[model samples]
Target: MSQPNTSPSGRPATLAPLFKASAGDPLLAMMLASGGDERIAAGPDGRNRYGASARPEAGEIWFSSSTASGVSRRGWQAASAALPFAFSAGESEDWFSDLRRRLLNLLAPPGAQAVFCASGTQAEYAALALAGARARPGQKIVNILVGPEETGRGAPLAASGRHFLNSAPFGSGRAGFALDGWEGAAALAALPLRNGAGAPLPADEIDARVCALVRVARARGAHALVHLLDSSKTGLSAISRDCATKLLRDNPDDVTVVVDACQLRCAPAQVRADLDAGFLVMVSGSKFLGGPAFSGALLVPGGFAESLAARDQDIPWPEGLADHFAYFDWPPLLRDRIAGPFGARCNSGLGLRWTAALAELEAYCALDPALIEMAKACFQGEARRQILMTPGLEMDESGGEPTLIPIMMRGAEKGAADAALRKLRRRGLHLGQTVPIGGREALRLCLSAPQIVDFAWRYREIGDQNFAFGPLRADLEKLFTAWGALLG
Candidate 1:
């Protein structure tokens, strides 16, 4: 492999490796190849199948982390740094194990474990498998997904123990078949977070519905895998943490609560709290963390694996799972619990992607907590203000953090919103994809951790008084200006 040219600061002189890692060993090829199916495939136009390129583009404003983002400079550097080592340790467990350890240290509480997957949807599939393994012999697995419309398109299929995609990340293609040993093992129940009017339902109403479903599942000898959505696509959470806790306490044996924190927009403390409460948490590096797409992990609370171990029930590993996950994906404690001749290999791309994401996360976490909150507040307030002030655009007022702002075009025809999105992208302003809210389709303006950290640094350098007049507001100004032109 050719060596990267370095400058006096010891950084690569160019981002060549960031876009395409230098070829040395065959393992580097595997790392680049593992971005998964159509989700990350680049098209003939040099863009990924998602219409975004793998490499970061200059002057392209990215407000799309609520869906996906190209690899940020920080993430790219981290991935580049890992390349040499990843090549050296081809298929070895050391690199993957260390990646898992780093993830747990950064996001999990003590004794917590993590199962890495190729994407958030894949993590959902892993969660279902774990829930299915824990079900009693006579009990059926009933998956209760919150905010199904706002979550991944493939989530329902994954929750039902079927292949959500035509091809798995690891190069296995089996579109709609039930996973091996999983046929007739699980059923899906969806609880919409919003009512028919596109209005968010009351928390109490959502809680009541969840309780009713859990009770029904329990009465029917079913294990209820209820999801607590921390943040959906447009940043709306369905069930409150307190409600999830109560349901778990009321039906500990029959209830399995998984927090769909795939957006990863909540605080680390919130995730630790979920783990402390014995709930499985799913997080994505590709979302708010601003990593390259297709990086996700399922966080297992401490002692949860031991509990599964104690069950000693012979849980047959679904043969289809071998296509999506490798042996190293699970922590040591879980490897032996599910019996199967699974792949004893490692996914180098998964490792590299996590490495990149952890870089962004660590940098963001290194900033002052107060500063982080302040930056988010300023950005959200300004972005919301601009969106409201813009003509022909209305904000979707579902209760969520300001990180993701969903706005709809007034009187837009069917599919016009999507065309407008393409127009905005062509004009060099990138926002989130269109999401359906009630009868209207809305586009999102999202804020990522890297964006916050960037603003925070500028804020610190320029002092608090000049902060408001700085780049943060300037970015919002640029966004609203482009939006207004599109409306015109």
Candidate 2:
């Protein structure tokens, strides 16, 4: 055996070491061999697979909002700074308390209370549970799907043990049914949740349908608890604010509204309006905020705590679910009773991840609105121009604006879009992943703060140039050119 190598800085060398050992030590030898391979490939491209290269993979654009994101340099810096606090003395004090309050001030409606959770899925579950607890004796949960594409899986869990319509089949894939059953608190889907187009439904129709549903629930000895999706996979503003407001006003007792702002793409005015009207808005930092994946929170309106306290002792909160919400610094009433178990056991990594997200959100908020709009226009104009010009590509213009652009590929092959995407990824370019659109595979070009700042795709190349807001003609052209060549 031999000692490990060291760099001039006294840190371990970048490469691994191997040495001869006894024949009886086969396991140790194998471990040494694996370590050596890891060291050599540490800086190489595609070493860990997924096509990343040593010299920095080119055109590593990220448009997938759900799974992952390209964290900005500032975000990484904030994480590095906040990590020690999270690991050490951060637990005793509410380290993220100030951060959460600031975020609520910036992103949520005035006077809204926030509850931090691990991911959008978890937050949605918590929101559903909270709403279900408020359900009246004859009321049932009604989820109206704007499209057949289901974005949040935990949604149907609110309807667990109750029959729900228009939701994805129960127990599809890895997800199972919710365990705790609330008496009249179970969710009931407003069935046939199928809308192919991404355009907004008519306001009158929206109001009428929601009100009618509430009436039906009332007649059945139940209130209609609606989880209206403001934006899901399809894009922002999926449900009309006018409808949400009208429903709330018309059926104050019969209807409870939860605005699914999971994408975090809702405009400031829109979010404030919803919150002001007393709607619960759920948002994730991982999406439009461009933080790491899975960080999310649920914003509760003022007086919500009082309303929850007014309810009887039974809220049907599933056992063990309280642990995920342990990060929230609850108000006195909730602190003592409702969510006492929460914050009792917290995850340091989640707290650190949110701190990083807060950093990203801060940077985004700091930029001038005019500059962001201008850059958005520039990027969208160029992208649309090239997409139309490209023979194999077509733009899905039903929903458009600041970010999350969807484009359809012209071809008959089942996996044509994904196949071309793989080719580009192999060439060091990663456009967003493939998603089902209109019964076919399509691609999304989601823009984040890093992309808006015109940072190069290579992680190391960011911050090498001054931040700029200008035409993205070159970048769009490059992406389409590569895609065209691959199609050819």
Candidate 3:
């Protein structure tokens, strides 16, 4: 019955009614109208994320954490200035060397046992390259993932499990898979060592556990290379942890383990432990740390790294590059020429350095001590309101990453959801539309917004109503007071 209105600063006054709303995304409308047609207009109006594209008009922009965090302008400026420096991989001899030695520089460690890669794809490629060089003919290699049947996190298929499939001899013409649960426990107590559908070996009985892989690799002989992508947001994959505990207990010396830490770089202690356990680890600079995009690193055991020197140069190794998992490839060298200090398996051409992001993360790595406390305090008041305001949105009260929030509308179907998004977009609110996820269309809001605009104060006064940023409450009410109107 009452109308909602905004004060000069875009704050809501009270339980306001809807404002006049349009059906298309506000920015898209601006861009399209600039052309006056459904097809996008061209010329010097605006530039899109893809670069020089007329799709994104001059004033209108697609929100992406990719180019910059929509958090604060200053934060974005700082990030860009740091890019060139960040693109250079840190080495003891480089400008970033000192920074890498610190805890904040997890993506690129000082005194790197190996250069992980400038990108995750490259890091994975590096790992595969190592595998090709090391695996005995007929030995199988495996790639791993986390998440359940449909909801599990999948690294691009181009990147994750394809390595072994490409390395034929050990595969018995068959590929290997290493899967784990969200909690670092095995999926049905299965190990990566086992081939598909092979009966899992018993954990308590070491011999039985050994049999799983023994049987799978039998046709290819007893050799196999295995990779574990720490798709687990926390640290260890459920299956990997369970298997690791048993594997180390029974026969640690027999298995070669490599971990994809590309997503788990923030969890340093866990990564260090994985390295100590003789697993090679890959990590990226972006994701959690919000660093430069094309930067990441890998950690290899001192012994495993040395093993590279033993390879015969006469043999040409397969290229191990991927779209996401790994990077870099070393050129073949004469056996006698290989007698000195080595750099890294891969090098970032733009140099895959995220110097600035790592510098920024120095404080976050110390998060248990300082910044996290401030963040908690900042969110304390808003947390209650958010928990209450979200009528049918999905948020895990139990446990999940605090940075990105993935949500969905309770009753809205795909088309309905899309239409509503278009309506919201016409206003200035600028939230993301639903994308296909886990086989269903869902919406995601990825942010840990740095304070810029006063959001909490506005919500207390108005619910889901955009200020000047959105259509007024009275107008929205006229548009959708009934279910039939929305249906049409």
Candidate 4:
């Protein structure tokens, strides 16, 4: 059969033939069936009713971080300069590395090594591969701990034969583990960090359990990769401090820990402290920074860099995935044996995405701490009050001061939650995906800097609940009005 014709811009003439041709590819088939195209319904303003719109919507209220982000005016301005370059550049010109440096300087400490990936999942796969490589040569198993929740859409796709330890409440604890078919790994173990109600386990008990797990894995000669949850869909600061300390402080040999900060919501001080304590941290530009979707970077500190660099072989990434990464962007030491098919330049939109992220970072850095605190208080208070009055929504109070609110939709079936989302979108308000929590359908409304700052600009006259000179009351009223009507 003749291949599909190409458009002038080089895209397939039609997606239908491509979908049919993709019958042998599981991932492609899933994409065609996932309704992703319909899910991002565009509004009259040219933005997805969800965020991630290329253009601005004057009054759109976005509470969706599980999905992509909306472009801010400043972000758009920053990204615009790169469009010509992205569309016309013939060869890669260290654009990704430059972006990596800017992000590291803003988010991490000096001397921290960086690697840019297509998405959080790509960075995570590299981390996992490095973790397995750090194991002793004769060891055939590299067991890992995944906590709070796995929100990176590409994570499972990257795990080939590794064992995962579930640290989320009521999580399966073991994914990708098969005794008979085990190839890249040996065994898996899972421990609940929180109970079914979202309350964490006792600190001492958690510490003891983790220590025991590590010791047992050591005894069995398995390499342990401990994942510390910095923030994910469940909420920020989801890990138990005591448990993380025990795992990081006095751990067994052949163990490595990575702080999953992919949500990009963690503070600079938090990241510094974690890196100072010798843990690998992964962060993304797409989440809190409001950049375009699928941009990620890994901050490799001294010890982890040394370990990963010492390995002479490349991490056995999935077949055909090397093309998606900018291996040259990795720290020079760690780039030792990573072979190519590597791009000559940044991925299609990465340069523009990073530019947008850097623009947001600049604004965020210049904000007064007092203003930030005031905005946080205002949004949290309003969100909590709104949740109480909304009929179908209930808050998941398993974590901190409601940075990312997880809610279960009452009377909504497995996929009925999407209908509620659609209704909200039609009203020009966008919430995140309806995720699965404990066999029930759930959704998240994440607080973002752009949202808060925009509100501050639009409602500059209105005072907050504390009678402070911040947080426009009108914005909250608009959001709550839309929310109540949609869910009520």
Residue-wise C-alpha lDDT for candidate 4, range 281-376, written one tens digit per residue: 888776777765546777778766775566666544443334345434465566654543343333535556667778887677666666677677
| Evaluation by lDDT, superior candidate among 2 and 3 | 2
lDDT of 3 by residue, 202-321 (tens): 333533443465345434343333445454332223335556545544544335556765654235777766766667777665444444344555566555555655555422233222
In order of appearance, the predictions have TM-scores of: 0.91, 0.76, 0.54, 0.76
Local accuracy of candidate 2 as per-residue lDDT tens digits, 390-416: 888887665544477877888747888
In candidate 1, the residue pairs with backbone N, CA or C atoms under 3 Å apart (3 or more residues apart, or in different chains) clash, namely 41-49
In candidate 1 the C-alpha lDDT for residue 181 amounts to: 68
| Model 1, TM vs. native | 0.91
Of candidates 4 and 1, the better by lDDT: 1
Count of backbone collisions in candidate 2? 11
Q: What is the Cα-based lDDT of residue 425 in candidate 4?
A: 75
Pairs in steric clash, model 4: 52-69, 52-70, 92-344, 92-345
* Ranking of candidates on lDDT, top first: 1, 4, 2, 3
Q: What is the lDDT of residue 41 in candidate 4?
A: 37
Question: Which runs of model 3 end up more than 4 angstroms from their true locations?
Answer: 1-118, 148-156, 159-237, 248-254, 310-316, 319-353, 366-384, 396-399, 415-441, 445-488
The C-alpha RMSD in Å for every predicted model, in order, reads: 5.5, 10.2, 15.7, 9.0
Candidate 4 Cα errors over 4 Å, as ranges: 1-51, 87-92, 148-150, 153-200, 203-205, 236-242, 245-253, 310-320, 341-345, 409-414, 436-440, 455-472
- Taking all chains together, the TM-score of candidate 4 against the true structure is 0.76
lDDT of each: 0.80, 0.56, 0.37, 0.59
